[model samples]
Target: MRSNIYIGSKRRLSIIALGLIIFLFTTGIAHAQTVDGNKYQLTLAEAIRFAKSQNKLVQVATLEESAAKEDRKDAYNAALPAITANGSYQRFSQLTLFTDGLSHSTTGPRKPSANGAALGIDALFNIYSGGKQRALQDEQQSRVHLARLNTLDQSGSIALQTAHQYLELVRLNDLQKLILDQLNRAQTRLNNINSLYKNQKVTKSDVLRAEVVLSNVQLSLQENENDLTITNRKLDVLLNIPDSVRIAPVDSAGMPKPAIDSLLPFIESAGVTAYSVQKIKENIELQKARVKGVESSNKPSIGFYTAYGLNYPNYLFFPPVNQAYAIGFVGLKAQYSISSLYHNKSKVAAAKLRERELEVQQQANNDNVRTEASSYYIKYTEALTRIAVNERSVEQAQVNYRIVNTKYLNQLSLLTDLLDADNLYQESRFNMIRAQTNALNIYYNILYISGNL
Candidate 1:
């Protein structure tokens, strides 16, 4: 009786452990599902924001902007007085002097010290550098401005790219559902055809035709799934997300279409406020500054210089002194490079040419921006038109599909007619989705080209 009681306790314990394991497993799965569900949900604006922050191109542009800032600082520092301190120690093995006379004689210090040390601080402030200093400073400032513009440009580019991929993913997601529905329909039709064949109502050829349609649809679905995988991975890289995470674009159904009454505003904005245009303007300024810098080389430079020092053996005196002595001096210095007058002519011309080249480039960029903006606007309008047309087509195709299906069921239509109607319905739906996504993409493109995205 005691043994039976122990066995019963053991069995109860075993059952309890089993139940605990099952509970933990179920809880873990539920938690994982919740986390994964939250992780993959993303909106278009959120995706663009994430890409701007995490894209490698945007990050690199930001780093370049930082470097340009440092360059500006260095240029500013160049305008300030340079101060430096230096110290030196030397040991002399021997000290000798020669006296110039009819009978040449060599002399030595009475009590020469073997070691000598010196310390000094010197400062030089530029009073004038023929405007070179100002020109260089201006050039560096222009560089900083250009870098900032470049960062903005890169951020915009990344945003647009992210939007494209995100929209494509959304399109694929929608298509996936539509294709699945088509697959189910195809499967049902095939099953019905088989049933009809068994009952001698339809021939074996009907079953084979249905099978082919199903196979083609299955292939299409597989291709779309592959495209989804690739697009998701690309978006993950842009957002710096883990590959294991899958993104699900928020449904854009019933989202209001972007509206614009005219393309003139976009084209105008692209010419004035576009990052490309701004960068070129800054580059032209930079080239002008460089020309000034080169021309300044033909002029003279002037500065104030001062130095103070303490030396162990005062070499300033004719006779060597054992005690250390302090020495200081201040003076104005000026210099001219005679060769620069001739040598810099070519350099100045080259700089001016470069400035002109930038001006030409600026004009070209303006033209390109206008053209690109107008192109996108036109495309956007075209997509809107397509959307309307495809909507009507989908409605008509759906009606036709229903009619043909009913006729086939009533033995009043051939299987081919039903299959064709089904194909038209699926194609119309696909086209409608494409038109919607394409319109969204082109709308964003317009914003991107105008630098307003």
Candidate 2:
């Protein structure tokens, strides 16, 4: 919300305005932006780094992290002794010790010259007040720790989402290419059929079907290209970059090849890691609650302070005289409000209940995290297998299309048969690419589960 905009640039404070208008208007932008001029160049590592540093959500996490660090420092400082200093100066027309007109000598009011100043200092070292200070310090520390852990949790979430978006963009790019390829093939077939019909070797229906197929493919390609433009804009906003910037996807050769053998180990490790980290954080809170309970039971407090001034008189008795006295007194003191009997039965009970609640929550979290980690691991391996099988299927489909087209040219296949085979081939290839992209994403998903991404 706070930024220095170039002259005449509207304040882009909300997604509704930009997303509905300028950001979505990707008329001049190309799909798949590249950092360098290398061909086929989007990489997982690059995406991860870019998202971590540049994503709008990631920036918010960074700010929370910075604030947490400051809070931790303040909590740590609370353990030290507290010191305070105060000073004041004032003047009055008269300082009355005793006045001349009392009840006639039964009382006396001494006249005093009017000026005074006070300077005082105090230092209260926590000798020990039933552990209240320590408890408060612990609570502060726990809150700080929670801020950091939560940031990491959010980081993992953001990374997973970005990876998904990036993978889908890649899919859209590949699908667009496939659509173009299909369009070209349809046009070539249409030309062949028309030539054959001119020689009285093909039916009019064959020419008509080929032209229709080409028209359909062309229309689909147009829509796909538009969708790709929109996808690129979404990615640009995430990267905090200009949406109109050009972009292009890398080839399959750059996708990650995960270590399949470690899949189970990674899952197990993620489960255990989550449990341990959560226990460490939760225990801190419980310990703080217990410390507070003890301090309240001890029922102790204090309040005492002293202030003094240098003695000086600027006026003389009756005849007017000037005098300054060099005198000062320093003293130390303290007071206590100790309970005569135990009075906090409810607080102790609440602390015990709170600790029990954390224990229950810890157990619940372990169950949930284990389930998710295992599921993610199994999904990774399954996706890998799917991609391999789908790739082979697509290769075979390509061969089928080539053979069918050649047969049709030789008058051995029907026009409908040829069109259907081409459609199947394109669809198969797209499926393969999608499976591969998803597999690559699932493999990296292990890091997200372990909170290491």
- Model 1, 1-453: lDDT tens digits are 999998997776556434433433554422212124224566787778767876888999999999999999999999899999999998876545556753666656444477889999999999999999999999999999999888888899989999999989998999999999999999998988888889899888888989999999999999999999999989888876555457778746335677767655776788888888888898889998999899999999999999999888776667776889998999999999999978988998888988899999999999998888888888888988998899999999999999999899778999999999999999999899888988888888887778777
Candidate 1 residue runs with Cα over 4 Å from true position = 1-39, 95-113, 262-264
* Poorest stretch of ten by lDDT in candidate 2: 23-32
How high is each candidate's TM-score?
Answer: 0.87, 0.78
lDDT of each: 0.84, 0.67
**lDDT over C-alpha atoms for residue 335 of model 2:** 41
Model 1 is weakest, by summed lDDT over 10 consecutive residues, at 29-38
What's the alpha carbon RMSD for model 2? 7.2
* Per-residue lDDT value at 383 in model 1: 88
How accurate locally is residue 263 in candidate 1, as Cα lDDT from 0 to 100? 52
